[model samples]
Target: MEQGRAQNESAELGGNGHDFRPCQSVNFTVHRVGKQGTKLQELDTPRGLACSDTSCFVVDSGNKRIKVYGRRGVMSGLFSSCQTFSVSNSYWDFPTSWSPQDVAVDSSSADGDHVVYVTDLKEKVVRKFSHSGVYCGVFSDQMLRSPSNIAVDPLNGAVIVTDRESRQVALCKPDGGLIRRFTVPGVPRGVTVSPKTHNILVTVEGVSQPAVYTPEGQAIGESQEHENDVLDHKAADLGDLCVDEEGNIIVADRRNSRILLFDPQRQFVGTLLSRKDGLRDPCGVDLLCDGVVVSDLEQHCLFYVRPGVANTSITKPSQ
Candidate 1:
């Protein structure tokens, strides 16, 4: 991965060793993949993003497939709908077509292998896949209307799906049994499970702020205002979101064409990437060990960004 230089911008924070003073902007090194073609590295309307320790998964929505990339941004593999039919299944009950909108990876298995869960908007079900892209089975057909996005709980391997038509988030077992469902204010777009606190983070359509919920469906918190910002800190169009191990929330603000950072308390930190960084309608994001992988719809590509705090010592104050 080629390293890019960090662009400096001023930001303020309160307490937690991040005082309300002008500190150096967050640093980032970006690596991107894909172009306007049908190659393995090319993408079409890439939407949902999820990352395991070794690979990042992209929901190539327009292509009706999922593309996998290694940590260094190399194209690894891809998988599309399976057409195998069961003898016991009726003609109409067989898998005909699929439109995948989002994907999630479960890497908490005891055997060290990861499992993939993909939400099919056309089928209204979540399909399971092995780590290397083997079709396992489909689940949640009876519970979802139009499944848009999905996530896996690291603690228990529960699959959480956001049903757009139902305006609900359904938590299901790995085997596809429904555990419970909760209603959100608007059409839920993105859903993810936090590894640190085990809380669920969800983004709703037309809602400027992301909402936090407990695993048991209790409302907890939403994005809060930043003290120093004169403009509204809320996102214009929110998309997929993921929480790092430290509980820091990374959100894809689509309309704003940028990626936002929020503390564990959902307080706005700052813009990590924006239009200046070549983003045009970023729709999905997932965290890597040292950075994040983002899917841009308009750009039709994926970006791996490693973020860092700028060094205040070398930064010159604006005069």
Candidate 2:
């Protein structure tokens, strides 16, 4: 059975010598106050967030829309009070009843175009749009029942989504063509693609342990490898997760009100951020070039945290 051995060859099966130990109390401070400026820029129950080199896309769940912000925290466009889109096309009509649950950015195109994939939990559909918020099209799959979380493969542009109602995970192309689907034991919550290995990391709804699988849906390790000390599978309230450049998994432990870390081999590393560091029920997390941005439900704001760095504040609006 040829499982794309060459692709898997470069992927390290273990941590790349990164010491999986707890760091000393690092300084954490409020880097950005709210999403942007003004009351409208403020976030209300923001759930899904993803970042790129220049901007951040946040799932403004309460507002039933997605908000885009620059690296310096300025509102981009489309959803702002001053800007409006040409809704002449029926597909571009206002999404008053849509409830966006998650968001991800795909930049693996030959022409270097970035596409944003957003999941509408209320309508059970995944929608695609340009980075500037132009409506593209729906995922249009019958298997996408109650799509919860979504992720994009940076190397191939494959979108992975968990269908809670179907109790399975579906791998689709950027245009929503079904490549394959596989069932898991428990309800899947958060799903992410490992940056170094390209493996799919999935967090179960009621299980603290997360499972890993190859792109072809082959389980990566023993059952014990999925269990960890930092993850609260019992609470099963884990939110969205992202892989760092160092191959570490940063998961939003919503039930514990902190973020947990794990090595590439699915080993428990340590607590990366928590309430002690000023996080309250953090939902979505994404790594920026300079720092990390977390969506906190209790605070109703995005907390910017930098590890092992002196505390500083950036109050200037993005230019």
Candidate 3:
């Protein structure tokens, strides 16, 4: 997940035109073949961002690689040598696909080791791996249909996923056996489950409301309107949901060009950032030690956001 400076610039929103609310001082730099120091993609459209030892693991969707970087967006040698996962076939014995839409890390597989799990959009599968980015394997059986998200349930090593074509969420084992299935409102795009709350949060596409439910699929809240009934959300397209230390939900409101902050109570705290907030079609959103991470699906980059910083300006959050 990536975050940009939440200061400056202008982006149109719902009924009321607004800019981004300054969250904190945040920035990012691209580290690629010719993009050292500062060379960044025109849009840096990354699909997912994972955290490891204060560094960010970003997946470049348009391209076919995953990268690791420091908090300042500096290049770290974590996923530089990582290969692409395919959809129709396998490469280097790894999975293949058209897009790497989402990823999850199995932090508790073996003594808190970081294992990466990526959801190949076109492949409709999730590939698991160890922290070293090894070709562990894929979790596919004949049940998935265009899966958009993946997460490893620490409870029983169940791999949870949400499918777009099926408009439902399915649970599976590493071997790809059907664990359970549940129906959702619409085409669920982004999904997140918290061990503490044992609840899964889903961001539905074409729907302004995000649904929060218990592990058993009981309703907790909906993202239709704010508690005060103010800010009417218009097609949130919540690409990512991150639960913080306090279980607060940091939603990457993709279409809105801003990140929405919600407490575990499902109350809208306020706007985190916007196009002016250094956000550009932010897709993957997750939390790390001291801040939030966002993946720019349009720029192929990972951005960082410190929730407690003084000022975050995104007039040009790019490298």
Candidate 4:
């Protein structure tokens, strides 16, 4: 295994003479095996991933379908092919075709159900489906044109989507009724609900900063320290983001080929995943209590990284 840059434990100090930020070094191992190879379970241009307690869902964008991989055991690691399934139909009730762009898991239904919400760029809607590959319905609205990314509010089961062409974020009820839409300061790319404050966090194109909004579509504030000012056409740009259990926002920094870590207050902590850590154009990220699973667009496969455990051995890629 290759050694990465040694961590700076005393970095990121505040006036109080203490460092509150998480370490910048990656403390996890990497696992590359997924439903690929000669077995015919090839993933084409995987762009999104979402995780639950027992499984990880991948949006095989180019293939126009979602792939579900079940967790084998506590120590079995991520994206095991032993128990897996795929969803191609638009909804469980209808056999319509779909071109999925991103995906999110909503388990906050009134009765506590786990429903998978995927953004269909072709249909311009967020499609709801059960965990077992049963499509429920579409969160349709006339204003939703070119739905790019989605995030589900675990507190209220509301679905939030970033409409790139419209330059706005739409908040909708679980049944697909529009609550309200907030205009993004710039073109919105990725959006996620902060688990700590339940606030809507959005990453805009050509802007290094992220905007924070309330669930009611009210502006809270924008992050100050995350300003990278990278051009939209630049090689290194922002990708999809997700909130970890600790309420920190994990961002996929594409061109940089790494994952960025920020706290609830939107303060930059450090780099979580990077090229030195074996990530290349990692576009989609999802967290687990023990680790994270990311979708590599260039590699066309899912990888598992165990954060917080330094010098962990890298797993060999599957045959």
What candidate 4 gets wrong by more than 4 Å, as runs, is 1-26, 35-41, 81-97, 110-112, 224-226, 229-236, 307-319
Global local distance difference test of model 2: 0.66
User: Candidate 3 regions off by >4 Å?
Assistant: 1-44, 70-98, 221-229, 232-235, 307-319
lDDT of 1 by residue, 1-319 (tens): 4355433333322211122222344455566777654455578788897877657778777766777765432222122222211111221122237888889999889997888888887878888888777778899588889888899998999999998888999999999999999998888988988887889999887765679999998989555323334225443577899876667777788877877777677766667677777878898888654456789898788777654344322222122
Query: If both were scored by lDDT, which would come out higher, candidate 1 or candidate 4?
Result: 1
- Comparison by lDDT, 2 against 3, better one: 2
Point out the higher-scoring one by lDDT: 1 or 2.
1
| Weakest 10 consecutive residues of candidate 2 by summed lDDT | 1-10
> What is the lDDT for 310 in model 4?
43
In terms of lDDT, model 3 sits at: 0.58
Taking all chains together, the TM-score of candidate 1 against the true structure is: 0.80
Q: TM-score of every model?
A: 0.80, 0.79, 0.73, 0.81
Taking the tens digit of each residue's C-alpha lDDT, what string does model 4 give over 80-113? Answer: 5532233444322223477888988886666646
Deviation in angstroms for 192 in model 4? 0.8
Report residue 247 deviation for candidate 3 (angstroms): 1.8
**Candidate 4 RMSD to the real structure:** 6.6
Weakest ten-residue segment in model 4 by summed lDDT = 10-19
Candidate lDDT scores, in order, read: 0.71, 0.66, 0.58, 0.68
- Encode model 3's per-residue lDDT on 66-155: one tens digit a residue: 554444432222233333333223333233344777777666556766667777766666776566556677766368888777766655
Residue lDDT tens for model 2, 255-311: 778777666665666566666666777888876544557888776777765433243
Question: What's the C-alpha lDDT at position 120 in model 2?
Answer: 84
Model 1 spans > 4 angstroms off: 1-26, 71-96, 222-235, 307-319
